[model samples]
Target chain A: MMEKYHIESYCRIKDQRISLNGATVFESAETNFLPFIKEAYKTLDTQYPKFFKMDALSKLALIASDLLLKNMTEKNIALVLSNRAASLDTDRRHQQSIEEADHYYPSPAVFVYTLPNICLGEISIKHRLFSENGFFVFEQFRADPLVDYADGLLKMQRAEKVLCGWMDLDNEKYDAFLYVVAKNGIFTHSKKKINQLYQTS
Target chain B: MNKVYLSYNNIVSGYGFDTAAAVEGIKKEDACLRQIHDKHLLPNHYCASKVASETLEEAYAQLRPKEAHTHLEKMLLVSLEKTIRASQLELTDRVGLIISTTKGNIDVLEPENPFPKSRAYLGQLGEKIRHFFGFQNEALVLSNACVSGVLAIAIAKRFILQGTYDEVFVVGGDLVTKFILSGFNAFQALSDEPCRPYDKNRSGINIGEVGTSVLVTKKTTHLAEESVVLLGEASCNDANHISGPSRTGEGLYRSIVAALAQSELNAGNIDCISAHGTATLFNDEMEAIAFNRSGLQNTPMNSLKGYFGHTLGASGLLETIIGMHSLHQNTLFASKGFQELGVSEPLNIIKKTTPKPIETFLKTASGFGGCNTAAIFKKVAEK
Candidate 1:
């Protein structure tokens, strides 16, 4: 028998809009992810200046995770996030930096974010969550694995809560959907409910 | 809950197409990292253990793979087929496949490459591996930096324990690409000479390439000649820095503690350790602190980096495969290229290939995401 878990909260950031629990919290029509995410960061009224130094992918993950984890009391929240690009956005930049010997200058600042899971690091640092942290890459958003893995963590007591997410960025197109699962919450955690919430954005 | 065993495995790397060749080279103290002057592989000279095209093609040709595959796909398929054939199992829906790589087909993104840019997407790479093998489930691609290989095993164990799949085929690899080379070079983390992990005068990492595979199943009958039952595994974040390790080794210490707790063992029980010694200043120092904090400063440990030159995504799994052999052989392989202790912690770094009675060992990996994973494996008694 599987243990019962529930989705405590969910958030989506796409098309310059931030929605939480099916309600809009922030919106921007800047048409560019850079300017739009900047507005979203300001909407939070947060001052973690490190956010600005991050790549677009990390910024998106940080803000989406921030919204759901801000008022949470649980300390052992494990993060299991998946994405499609897998840091290609920053990989391209790093590749271009040393592409030509004449103009070779690769900055460690940009090189560090080449891995997809660095956002997990940022979120872990921000929340002081030292629990299990994982990052996976999928062709498209799939909720079944996320639900199954997170549920297992809770069932095995690896973590009291799990923050499952799908955050992807490629060629200026990106979408982020994050949800927290706990023992008690609003909706029962299931693949069906997760997919519906992802679409509800 | 079901007990999971890492039964069948293979390691295809620069040493050769088989795991035995690698272990043999290590025992003989052969130079694993070599000088590569290939213009096609890279413009500058590199000290890496990259599988030559002829070596991979000759082995891959034996498989008669049809469609044109990238270098990485070839490496992965060659390694995957070895384990699949050794296991002699059906690839039904009960089986799951996981492809772990930090940057799969990343060279496709370079202008010098001819493959379609679509190959650079990690999903497309996963698709290639899955389609070649006809895995029942959509392949799971784990791309977490450095830790992906070991973490994939932990996930495979959870999958079986959760009744999600009966078996999982985990294949992990990463190329020594200009992309990664230049990136590490930018951080000034790439060593010009062969890496000397934990040596007093150590330099930095020698980026290498390898494709490794292992089967995780609940049945002991499927165990290979050299196999071990997984006792426990856990991953934790430092919550410290994304790129840098914690000064206190917090994440790694907690990971070992949690894993030991799960394994029902204490620090004193671990016979050996296969560490993630990338040979960087901070990484080695950090591991020293973490092992010291966990009361494992005196454990017989070796970093196989000198033997494999840090195979990135495959390093953890490749090293784990070697550790499985170490347990079976009752031998402790030398921590090659180590002369004196470098870190502040007192470590019993293996200095020579000595025969030792061992049963259990810990495999640990920490990566750029501040992600750390610790997995404990123990030998099964003879039937």
Candidate 2:
């Protein structure tokens, strides 16, 4: 028989607004990407100095994961995140560094984040998760596949918990809807529930 | 446990176009690394293996003439075309497609690129392959750094065990581009000549490009002559650093331990080891420590990077295909460009091509973001 999983917790950040379990946690009309993300990081009140060096996408994912994973201390967590742009925000910067032949100088710091999965690495480093993690790039927000993959991991005993969702950033526009999937929660693990949580803007 | 078999594999690399050509090339001890001197591509002449433009176009045209595709797409189509034909399996709803790549068509992001910017997204590349093949299910794109290739296989096996799909086709590839070249150059990880893995005087890596495809299915009735059963697999992140590997080789060591435990096999049972072996100083040392810790120090191991030059996401799958050939032919190929023992611990590195009754082998890969994957394969028994 197939095992059933549930959503233990959820968090979303659209633009500068933050929410947890469909309730608004913080809202700001700030349209600038840097200030908005910085303020959100400040609100967390944690001393993670490495947060400043991360790209916008990693920052967004780190913040969302920090909130959803609060008070949870499980090391066997798997990360399954997807996006539409897929590091294009950083790719452009890396591209600009070598766009001109006379002044070509690409920074290694920017080049490291060109792959979308680096954000997952950041989260794993912060939380000490050495479990299964995969990063998928989609044309849009895909709910069914996300649910199926996360559930499959849990069902196969590959992971005790899963941190999965859609986190995308491009051109100062960002949206992240991250949730924790575990063996206990109120909402049953299903595509419909995942879609509802993703759409609760 | 549900049995999973990887068969009907195909490869498109600098050596040749099909699996037969690649296997033959390896058997004949041919190194595909070529010295390239294009200023726009690299600052200095570098040894790398890249499929010629005309050859890619011709192979792609034979597969899909009317449809226009990117270079990466062309390589994938040509490779998958052969695998799909050999399998002769219908594209029913039970079949799935999984593409493994780190940067798909990233050259399109160049200022002078002709293609649209959207082509840079890996998902767009997946869509091209999916629509061209007319796969019944949505395609899965795994882009978790360098382990993306082998990790795709693990994911495909899980999907089958979970009863989601009966068969999954995995294709992995990456192309040599200025973007990739510049990035590696920034880290001073590019080698001027062919890379030498585990050599005391080894330098950095040489970036190569290739596309490889393999069909994973549960039904053994359609298994090819070279088919090997997937025994067990495991993936673990070091949780140490995003760019640098762990000095302790903790993640890879743990992965090997878990995979061996799951397969119910001991290190003594593994006939050979196909290591990641990027030829870099840190990577080779890290792998050495991991293998030593896992008690695989006595296993005959070789790194194919001397010929393939670290194909990134495609390296794991490409090297695994070579391992499949190794098990079938019972021949152990020499680790090209390896002159002497480099790392601290002693490993029985294969220095000469020798024939042996190979039965089981392990394929391991470690990549950026401190990700490592270990998979065990055993040759199938006759009925």
Candidate 3:
């Protein structure tokens, strides 16, 4: 029988609450994404101050990825993420910066975060992961494509592990689900398990 | 593993519709990029390739669709229809589709545009393309900055090789809109003149709009006369900077080395290179370092940025299509606008269109988010 890949650990952040392996690790009373994410970072008290510079999407992804990968020794983990908004939260900000001629002043810092994959870049820099990276865009949090791609990379020996995730931020409506896929763990890494964890957590 | 082949393909750009027209224009060293004075797209005069909506509509009118479509949608429709017609394949459940773009329908979000803002979502764009053709499987929308187009090919190749799909249709495009232009301008990445990749006097990059589609399949039937076999492909992140190329070209170098390893070949097997030469000082120099590090410094290489500028998401596959033609015709297209070697590393930049016995080529693209992808291909007919 073929060995199944396992969900080594999973993290979910939604509705101002974050969970790791189905247990609440962080919660915030703030409804807004910025405040909630800021609170999540403060609780960490990590020395990485570059977190203050990230856009909303990257911040959201960073929090989930940090919880999942902080202590792991693996550096060859590939990052495969999907989102629907695709940096739209920042896109709107960038559009507003240039829409009005009288107030037109497009800052490069704001413009740099206009692509969703920049979040993947953020996570990679923090984790020192120089492995494969892909940012897929979907309407909602679908687990099949993300899982399939990670599985392909692992089966092909492209990466020692894969950090598969779905991190999206568009105004107040946001979701972050991240997991590490490895050769063995407590739960099998499959589409059904991912969907269940996403829905229940 | 199933052998994946890149077969029928088409491109819709400022040059013209279809790959042949773009090839013809490139043969003449005519660039599609020109000075744009439209305040609607950008306030200042910028050199970028802007495909006219009317020209695309005219070409699309022949298709006879039921309703009006957005400019990007129309471009993809036209390009995909031609590619499907050439491939002569039906939309089957076993087949897949991948849509690649940095931004899709972003212009629809403009306050004046009639379309609802929801249309700006990448998933909505995927639904539009998928339903337009009634494909069975969901379209995989890849939005990894500029590497989306070439990486889409790699993703499709994986699906087909894994037996999840017998074949996959890949479409990619992005528009030259105020949204993209303003962003590039803010970065000071746009060049006043047509981009000259690897040239000592090169200023910067010129953004271009292009829509391209290609068919990747496991079967040998209905293949293009000049189809190529997918040898190896890999994607890597710099883990360095989100918006800047790595000074040491670490990510790109790793990606090329990994891809070559997958193909069971080395630098000597790469007859030519289709580099991700955005013509920016940092980007071109980074590529030169990476290529030289890969021992491809003497390989005949060229950046098509002069003929079409930097097409962003469309560049990887668009340039790969041109590379396909180069292999088929045994011709090395000139790296237009290149006058002098600008980078520290030495490269045999093809200065003129000439005949060469080519068998394999490499296509690379690097974008913001520290993303880089490399795909290697070999001429199938000769193999």
Candidate 4:
């Protein structure tokens, strides 16, 4: 049987309320990846130095995941992310190694970021989420699967709460959206209720 | 729960995208290995395996959106085109698009240009694909490591079962870039020769690129006779290491067990297993241990990496599609380039070609971040 889970809190970096829950905490199309990271970092009460450069997706995932970790303990939370670009920064660095024939050596540090789920690693290390963590990438973001995965995690009682979302970074733009899903009796959705939510959304 | 039927699946790889064509190539048993005669490219490396003809850039060029798109965009377009064509479904129909890839447009970053402030390029890829096909439903991207393709299919099945969308399109693709090649090379993970899975002489993995897509829908909708049904799937992380598998294969064992339990099938029920035979020593040994732990040691298994090299993110679906074709055609494929057993535990690696009434198949993959996934598929009876 599929487990029942509810969205505890949600955050988005889009311009409109695209979520079925009709919860729009933040909306912005003007903010770049760095500003968005800064905004999320500000909420986490973390200082972001200007020189601390990393991949946009990594920065976005770290900051957003930090916000999710801020309210809850880091013991059991699992980070599951879906995005289009796994790690663009590492990809660029690797490409440069080939383009420049003379100084062609791929950095293992940069190459490690090539995997899509590395953000989960970054988040886990920062928050000490030593539980389950994985990443999934697809052509686009489908809400049903996202919901199902969260529901599965909760149903299996793998974690008390799961932080899942779509975080994709490319070029000058980054979009990071996340929601915390839990099995609390107060906030829960049945299969029928989930269907209705999508129908109404 | 509603029954979800996996409909059409297609792949555009070095061996050719059409199912019949690829199957023929597979039957011919041609190894896609070439000796590096050109000293100019790299002198010391004696052997380097690559996808047949056409580099990733060339394949992207064939898609014809020469100017506006990046490598990821072009790959998506090609994969979507084949998938959409195979499904014969209207793009405007209320269906979801689930894309799986490792590195998206990360190749867009350059030293001189660096990543821009907006990072809009990533979002634009999804939005543009959605716009191009006019999909009314949501578009999702799954970016897990090598297991991403299978994970996408698993997610699509859940959505269809939960009635979130009547139909879902699952696409997985990745491109070979100098970044990945050089990185794998740096780690000494790249096999100088064609990958030899489960072979005593096996060295490491040879990187390859591929794109594959599948259409899944609720069971209420009738599909053609060739459509395959995804029975069950499970994914779990070892939390053991960031870049290697758990020697005990704890996460992998759990995932396989969960998947089998979800499908309500025992270890003996699976006719064949598609191992994530990257030919890497640790990966093969870990998989062997996991298979043994799952009590699937007797299952006839093979790895398609020798034919296509390690397709990273695309392998999950690419190999799944191959397994589906094998089941449909009733021919068990040989584990290409398997001459000797490398692991301590003896695995029933399919060497010579054989025929079996394959009603069910199991596909599994493990990646760098201790991620493991197993998906089971059963042959659908013709109505």
Candidate 5:
């Protein structure tokens, strides 16, 4: 007998606005990404001071995950986040630091964030998750593959829940749609429902 | 759940172009790490295992007409072509493609490059491979630092268990680009000499380049003689630091424990261990602690880094393919440059080549961002 999974909670952040479970959690007047994300972090009162030092992608993912996983204490959740641009924004910055002919000093801090999945590590550090985690790159938010992979994790008993979705950030524009999948919830675990939540706003 | 088998693998590295040639070099305890004098990477010459560009181009040209493919893409296509041809598996809707890479075509971002900037995106790289091979399914690209290679195998197995696809081809690759070299040099993690894992005199890691591929499928009829059963796998995060690994080796310990539990086998069943010994002070020390905690202190362990020079995303998969050969040939390749115990805990490192009847082995990898993965493989007898 296969056990059914459900989408327990979900949150989306884009265009300086945020929503959780189809309700408005935040909407900022500022269009710039740095200030808007910092305001969200401050508003949540997250104790993670490391959030300030992260790159834009990590900051965006951290805040979105913090909101979605709020009031839930389970740390064994699998993370299956995807992106299209990856850490290109930071890659550009890192490239600039060394591209100059005479002045070249590539900082390890910037180089560490070059990989897209470092956000998964940041989330793990913040939430103490020691389970299966993956960072994928796709052309768009492909809901079918995400749902299939997450469902497989649960079916194999590899994880009790999964924190899966898309988090793409480049330049000043960013978008994230993260959701938690578990055994029981308000929404049935299906490709249509996952796509619907992704297209909610 | 269906039993998945990993077979029909191919490796393209600095030593040789294919599996047989590379394995022959390994059996003789030969290493290909040469001094790289490229000024863009470092002012001082450093040792690295880089495949000759002409070699890659020549091999790739034999497979497909010379087009606008990037070096990394060429390597991947060549590696996959061999495995796919051997398996004779059709790229149908039931088959999936998974690629593991840390930086795909990152060189495309050079200041004076002719390629489009979009090629720098890994998703575009995945598209290139998909269209080249005519894969029916959207390719899955895993890019989680160094653990990306082995983690792809775990994900492929899960996809099969979920009944999404009956066959998944995993190809992992990374090149010795200036971007990678400069980044490692910035961290002072590049070794000027060939790396010596577990040696007290070890300095740092020697970055290598390679492309390795393996097919994971439920169909057992066309399995290769060297096929191995995908028994168990797991990944865990240390929740400690983003760049540095935990001093306690908590993530790696948990990952190995989970994999062992899933395989329903104790440490005693593992005949050997292909460890992720990057030859760095912290990484080698961390692996030592993890193996000790997992009750694998006495297992015959060896790090393939000395032979391959920590090929980044390709290291895990390349090493696993070598482990499969290790089990099939009843041989334990010596840990190339190990001289003495460097870490506090005791490890039974394989110091010399020995012939032993081994049935199962464990492949472990830990990377930047405190990610750790452990997978167990068993040699399947041919019908």
Candidate 6:
């Protein structure tokens, strides 16, 4: 059995505000996530020039995971994500290529991200987590299975620490939440203490 | 970690909404194939068995007004409505929601003139469902190819044991569209005749659509006592092929062995198996090898694709729900279109309806991208 881990950092994208650290970073969904990413990168004081301009969803996940990675070492970190739509932007592009019969078929580059789990692949490459990875989608977001999946990974010793949450971007309303979980003695973060971290908010 | 039981499960497939209806239709051994006569779509290239109208209409009538209009929306909303209502749960209750699907709202992406935006689709369908129920804690979605539904259940069990959420609602669904149909056609995997899983003359798969929901909880209430409990589950990447399963069934074998180990049960303990018989040659052959390697060769197994065609993402939950229904009813539905053994490895596939005391069962699926999952369920004594 794996020991329970509490959610330390909680963030929500609502009414154009990225609520985290008991403060509102941005007030518009269109621009809020990018600033949130910039702020996260600023906190870490490390910047990846390649990720400076990418899809908002991928950038958001990268910055968020960077913040999560700061809390602990990168040993045995896993990335698991859930989404209602896989990559709508990429899908839209692929659909366009397919529709344009006269032109060449869509490149595999764009076609690959059309699958939802590709984001996990992106996060894995960014974090260097070559271990266990998976993506699940349903009509709506649910937590029981995600928690169960994370715990299973821990119990199986597949990953010592996991970055798990939901990252969804379709039209304009993009939202993502993530938490880090590890063994009892592997890190200093306490499940109970972490629960209190959210209490002040 | 405490063991979280899968209390109640149900589905709305082409055959019907509930298990009784699906099983009854299966017992009759009816093939619900229909001709592709719609002028808007290609003709004669594709055919499928669809769920009856009454079942869907009845499901629609029961849904809340806000959830009943759209096609994909209605499929998910109605299934969840019945799932919650059957479980006797309040919408405000603290529970996790796990939605599993592949190509959700892909139909919304149609109309080539102006491409539809994905965010609007998510808000109208995905967020709408969350806000409708007020699930304030955590709502996650899983879209891992075709194994999404089965993976959803495995994740729910993990969360409950870790004490993330007391309960979870696992919903899986997808609507059929020209986009998917054409894609499958491109892959050359659609069978004109009714699909025959493990048959010597097996063709390809008949793509179908379905929606299924199961309420899983850690609380062992009386209702749970009367339901099937999920014992164990495991998932493994073939790492062998992207579009096809390994001929040796390496990943599938590992997944089955892991699941059996997690449940602390040997191969002999399993009473039956719900094979992922997509009717494709490579898929059936690989699954047969995996079963043989896992010592499940003799277990009476069957595939429900003959009854509902291939529901893709919903197949995992839909099949598991049907498996639970078999335990409760003590009647094993035969593989609808099975005739002769096809694969090299021999499997004991049920040809006729059989009544036996089913204590435990296994449900397995293999999808594109080298993904495979196996789940174990145990029948419990009704309290």
TM-score of each predicted structure versus truth: 0.98, 0.98, 0.98, 0.79, 0.98, 0.77
lDDT of each: 0.90, 0.89, 0.89, 0.70, 0.90, 0.70
Instruction: Give the number of colliding residue pairs in candidate 6.
Output: 25
- Per-residue error for A66 in candidate 2, Å, reads 0.6
Off by over 4 Å in 1: B37-45
Candidate 3 chain B has its poorest 10 consecutive residues by lDDT at B35-44
Error of 1 at B158 (Å): 0.4
Candidate 5, which segments miss by more than 4 Å at Cα?
none
lDDT of 5 by residue, A1-201 (tens): 877899999999998899999898889998999999999888877768988899999999999999977678877799999999888989988888777759788889999999998999999888888877799999888998899889888887778899999999998989999999999888999999998888775
Q: Which pairs in model 1 have colliding backbones? A: none
Q: Which residues of candidate 6, in runs, are more than 4 Å off? A: A1-79, A83-85, A97-113, A118-132, A136-152, A155-201, B51-64, B112-116, B119-124, B224-226
Shift of residue B325 alpha carbon in model 1, Å: 0.3
Ranking by DockQ: 1, 3, 5, 2, 4, 6
Interface RMSD of each: 0.8, 1.0, 0.8, 3.9, 0.8, 4.6
lDDT of 4 by residue, A1-201 (tens): 654567666555543222323554444453455665555455446543421454566777766665556657536666777766556545665666656667777677667766768667556546655555666555555465566667766665556888887777766666677767776533464445444443343
Clashes of each: 0, 0, 0, 28, 0, 25
Residue A78, candidate 4: C-alpha displacement in angstroms = 4.9
- Check candidate 2 and list the clashing pairs: none
Q: Could you give candidate 6's per-residue lDDT for residues A1-201 as a string of tens digits?
A: 336654545554444455554566444434555565665556556455647645556666666566566556555765677666566755676566555446435444444445666455445545544344577554455554556666667766767776777677765567666667665432334434333433333
Worst 10 residues of 4 chain A by lDDT: A13-22
Two-chain DockQ for each candidate model: 0.87, 0.80, 0.85, 0.30, 0.84, 0.19
Spell out the clash pairs found in candidate 3: none
- Model 2, native contacts kept: 0.73
Q: Write candidate 4's Cα lDDT for B275-361 as tens digits.
A: 899998989999999999999998999998888888777789888888988888888899988998999886899998788788999
Write candidate 2's Cα lDDT for B1-383 as tens digits.
Answer: 78999999999999889978877887777888888898887677777889888988888877745667888889989999889999999999999899999998999988888899889888889999999989988788889888998899988988888778999999999998999889998999988888999998898899999999999999989788899998989899999998998998988998899899989999999999999888888999999999999999999999999888989889889998899999999999888889899999888889888999999999999888778899999998856
